[model samples]
Target: MKRWWATVPEIAEDVRDALAAGDDIHAIRMLMDGINALPAAQKAGTLDDALNAPDTTGDPRWDALLAGALRYRLHQIGEHAPSWTFKEPLEKGWWPFAYSPSDAYNDMAHTPAELMRLGIFLDEREFTQA
Candidate 1:
């Protein structure tokens, strides 16, 4: 199956850059809303299974940052946005309903290790544009 959160590093970098450049919630809102509207979901998995997945990637910082981004975005919206919801391709556990990627992202426990392996942390300074 294809990995959904795989693209998060690049997208997160963009979000981080926007946040650092004095972009308020409204600006962040626009960014999030716009991205969420895309045909492809940048991140994947249902809220249930994704939330329960192990962090085999061995990098806590990576997991923390990914989780923080999702949670922060949720806070901005006050609730689940319809565009953020989706279904997990492979059924793992006892989940009957599909989950929102937003929910999966918000859940700290489920941030995949693959997200960390992508080298998103290598250049934190690059996110801060002049």
Candidate 2:
């Protein structure tokens, strides 16, 4: 929970709202950008590093699973091993990242990394159905 963007409640709420509003892709992007913009104290670069890295061999354990999932999806689509990176701007979320710390203290909190993983979950449910 102490990872870079894990403590941001506003981002979480926004993602929830976006999901409720039928805007899942928008929600995912908002979460990504919000985490990217956080200050150094609360920011964790693990996801961003793995996403932007030239090679994924250096990715941390947590990110490796999701990153592998992403790579697999890309391969299924006939793409290269590493697909183009995507991140939504903060405006896509309902609230700004500036208010996330306070929201984390008093409300549900989640990091961009958490939300992105949610994206993978939805994708799997929607696309991998038997």
Candidate 3:
């Protein structure tokens, strides 16, 4: 499978393509599946690269969401995230998806540790689901 962030060219293409297509979810799914397909030893490093990849998509909100999602993924695997993942500003917002108040309540109620720390409220299923 192709990597979503294997090189500067690839990251630029993938990130910009998704923005042009108005499909942040597809971009994130590409990221999730890309990481999921990697060997255990490679997953964290690839995720870190994806996290650090420049935001060519011109969507800082999406960039922040990527940070939140990748950090959460790292935590799920018991890996320490790249320290930069936390140091940068959160870019101001909640999870970048729409949900009902009840859904927000539920996510808040069952907070996943790392995302909670990042102040991103999302169901882990956002990444955990196939």
Candidate 4:
């Protein structure tokens, strides 16, 4: 499979380097900056497209990037419009239930970045899980 990081722009190389160096803060900042630099309309549309797109690549890294981007956009939106809800999976192939951001993040995240990614399909977004 193609490496998702390789498909991203040059700025991603810098983020990847930060990640490899265990500087998650810097990496996240760069990621947020990259997302923020886009025009407001484009940023909203792009993020919506990314989040709603199907995950057919079957690549963990790709999923992580998608999820992380979605989370960051959602966070930006939430800053101005706080009324939002998310559906949380209850069981395998079972109906998902509504969850507040706080509860979902608490239950799903083990790191700040993970929380920033909203833990969407997290099991499929990590190398260790693969």
Question: Largest lDDT belongs to which candidate?
Answer: 3
Q: How many residue pairs clash per model?
A: 1, 4, 0, 0
For candidate 4, lDDT tens digit of each residue in 1-130? 2222211243365566666787755765555555444334343444333233332223344335534544444564563211222323222321011156664444344333433334443321232221
Error of 1 at 86 (Å): 22
Please state every model's RMSD to the true fold in angstroms: 16.0, 16.8, 4.1, 11.9
Query: In candidate 1, residue 124 scores what lDDT?
Result: 22
| Model 2 clashing residue pairs (backbone) | 4-43, 4-44, 5-111, 29-88
How would you order the candidates by TM-score, starting with the best?
A: 3, 4, 2, 1
Task: Spell out the clash pairs found in candidate 1.
Answer: 47-99
Q: Rank the candidates by lDDT, best first.
A: 3, 4, 2, 1
Error (Å) of candidate 4 at residue 114 is: 13
lDDT, model 3, position 79: 68
lDDT of each: 0.34, 0.38, 0.57, 0.40
- Cα miss at 25, model 1 (Å)? 24
Residue 44 CA error for candidate 4 (Å)?
15
Model 2, range 1-130, lDDT digits (tens) per residue?
A: 4544432344455555665677745655654544343443223434433334322222122133234334444444444443433323222233222245675433224333323332322223222321
CA lDDT, candidate 2, residue 48? 32
Residues 12-130, candidate 3: write the lDDT tens digits: 45666877898877776665554444334365455444444555456655555555555666666776666645535455537545478788887776656666666666676766553
Model 1 ranges with Cα > 4 A deviation: 1-54, 80-130
- Model 1 deviation from the true structure expressed as Cα RMSD, one decimal place: 16.0
* TM-scores for every candidate against the unseen true structure: 0.25, 0.29, 0.64, 0.35
Candidate 1 lDDT over residue span 1-130, tens digit each: 4544323334445545555575544333433443342223323333323323223223233234344334444334343423332222222221111156554434323322322233222122211221
Task: In angstroms, give how far residue 130 of model 1 lies from its true place.
Answer: 16
